[model samples]
Target: MKVRNDAYLKAFGENLKQLMAKSNKNAETVAALGGIETKQVYRVINGEHSATLSIVYAIAKGLEVHPKELFDFTFQE
Candidate 1:
């Protein structure tokens, strides 16, 4: 369970990073648009913590992308 959770977080984090890069918005701008703190953005992007679905949606919305984009992770066993 722990291993799966770790893998999930890593993949989610990577997805967030890619979206942010594609967004062309700096962390602070994205956080402000998402109505979250910059630190929270870093936390999610750095894989220091997992985010709730609400948070994921907010981030995707801020990035001007579909929420599904955030969940487009590679499958793992």
Candidate 2:
């Protein structure tokens, strides 16, 4: 069975990449701040793997941003 939610992960990954770029932070720095390995960040950024809530929370905290900011939402009328 697929454990990771693909759509959410993909969106999250894209947003994370954008955030990292905007912050001028590399994978190594993000990994250190999130207490994860650099490879994990690479995988997520590449959309090859998904991150758990713990990882997401860590990233948000490390970035000093809210989790909602990591998402791009669209509401239809």
The candidate scoring highest on lDDT is: 1
- The alpha-carbon lDDT assigned to residue 14 of candidate 1 equals 87
- Can you give the TM-score per candidate against the true fold? 0.88, 0.72
Q: In candidate 2, what residue range of length 10 has the lowest lDDT sum?
A: 68-77
- lDDT per residue for candidate 1 within 20-41, as digits (tens), equals 8887887788788888888887
lDDT of 2: 0.73
Q: Root-mean-square deviation of each candidate, in angstroms?
A: 1.3, 3.9
lDDT of 2 by residue, 1-77 (tens): 24345655666678888888888888888888878888888877776777777877767666667877767542222
Model 1 Cα RMSD, 1 decimal: 1.3
Show model 2 residue runs off by greater than 4 Å. Answer: 1-8, 73-77
TM-score of 1: 0.88
